[model samples]
Target: MAQQLDNDLQFEDRFHRKFYYLRLSVTDVCNFKCTYCLPDGYKPTEKKKPSFLTLNEIERVTRAFAECGTSKVRITGGEPSLRRDYTDIIRIVAAQPGITKVATTTNGYRMEKNVKEWREAGLTHINVSVDSLDPKMFYQITGENMFHKVMSGIDAAFDAGFEQVKINTVLLKNQNSQELPKFLAWIKTRPIQLRFIELMQTGEMDLLFQKHHVSGVSIRNHLIANGWLLKINGKNDGPAQVFCHPDYMGEIGLIMPYEKDFCQSCNRLRVSAKGKLHLCLFGDHGVELRDLLSADEQRTELISRIQGGLKEKAVSHFLDAGNTGMTPNLASIGG
Candidate 1:
């Protein structure tokens, strides 16, 4: 453990875990603030864009990650498409030395115009967050009435011929849990994978989490009763345990963060919008890699800092055991 821990910082850490996935947040801003994620009725437009890193700075840091054997990259944000140069960032990151796949998770509001452009720029995977299909419930959870707009954006992604167009549904109690079967039926014949994510413990999220948290186990039981088959180790892009019905064209995955199932094969690290590198999802405030990258430090120095951060990653968030606390706001952390 000490041998690899002291030697390489790109992927493998002191725990002997190799990290290949990178979650890069471009903008901390989002068009919609969900009920569980934001304080009551938050509006993103009220704030100015925070100090986001330049594309060139991101390029340098991404290059450093690639040098350390980071192969998969996911571009996330409040909504990654909100950035003016998101397409350019996709092109640039996709062109990096060791980076292979460049994917984005979006709310799908601003995705209509750029799906084609982004697909052409080496974006192979797209995950759209659609928590509830009902307009009223969607608005209640996301504080946005544009449910139809997000659906259209999903269609556009398929039309644009991206390799995968997936739906990420966060299962909040009383918000969308009862609608799980209906939502599953809605995707029966579509060429998109539906993933149900358990809300992570982040920010001042405990009160809301206490009220709204639904376990993935219960959701899976409900889905199974609805006749969804558990495809053993089914196809998935990330950590979600995937499933599917005999009738559906695409699969379903459950990102069970609350299940304490992440750390064993954990393969990703996150770079927050402000340039903090998170070795674990519920990790403490990470080293500010943006400061180092912006200062024109050599790639070796940046990698060294990343190595130092990786050494501190907790074995797990230990959510129910009270070992996990809210991370920085989900929007900033690109969750």
Candidate 2:
């Protein structure tokens, strides 16, 4: 039935990559000063504060995406839980007719305390950023001393009835690259899928990229040699290439954006917190969709704008050629 719906109202790019996943940024303000993305913490602009899409705007936009056959919506932010209406946002997106999975990428700042409410609000999957399992290294990478808290939050999510939780670890060259064994051991008995994401060069992280960028290819090779078998992705799955081991309770995933043909299987589209449609994360710029989001009656035009914008979607990101486009930092558009 879902495949039939996708066939009926497909949102496919010229390359024939059908988008069934949506990465929706609820806000761009993050509290933790992660060394890679935001080293200065979240700074507000001197000009009028940027307006984030409201609850009604979120609903309308989600409805249009659902109509276009998007089945999974991943809510992202500097830290989405920072917004007071975070749970409500989850509720609204989950309530949409065609959206089956409502997930989020969070820092787990409030997860320990509020994850129960968020789960009740209809959040299906959760990815928490745990840069390092070592307390000191975690603090060094994230500039936060809340390693224990975030760990507790992961535990709390399980207690709240979450089946499998995914942990995102940004592979830093000399930092957390050598800690894979530690991560593997932690996930061995737990239902946690540890994802090792290759750090790519954004416009703002040139020097850091040169110094600490570790290719996820190395990790993928390690997994393959260690008897882990690759798993096929579901239609609504994200870009991660997953692998599982017969002995471990958890899995491993590698997200290598710099890998060749990374964009060939692109199945997701990103929307900024301010209602701008980003065709590609490393695309030159975004097309504004806020003007069409003001009223419910404009759903047709909104969907039209989305469908029209796909024509301009590039076949691949130019990261290998050293182009990061208008994306200064991941936090600006919710990486």
- On TM-score, the leading prediction is 2
After superposing candidate 1 on the true structure, give the runs of residues whose Cα lies further than 4 Å from its correct spot: 1-10, 40-49, 222-237, 295-297, 324-326
For 1-335, candidate 1 gives per-residue lDDT tens digits of 11222334446777787777899998777878787676553345436646787898889888888778777789998788878999999998988876777889998997777788999998988989898988998888888889998888888888899756888888888889888668767777776788888876666776787888888898787668878777664112468787777778778888887665576777789898778897766775577887678655678888888988777887776766755544756776788
Q: By lDDT, who's the top model here? A: 2
- Residue-level lDDT of model 2, residues 278-303, one tens digit each, is 99889998999999999999998998
TM-score of 1: 0.90
Worst 10 residues of 2 by lDDT: 1-10
How does residue 204 of candidate 2 score in lDDT? Answer: 85
Off by over 4 Å in 2: 1-8
**Candidate 2 residue 208 C-alpha distance from true site, Å:** 0.2
Q: 40 in model 2: Cα distance from truth in Å?
A: 1.0
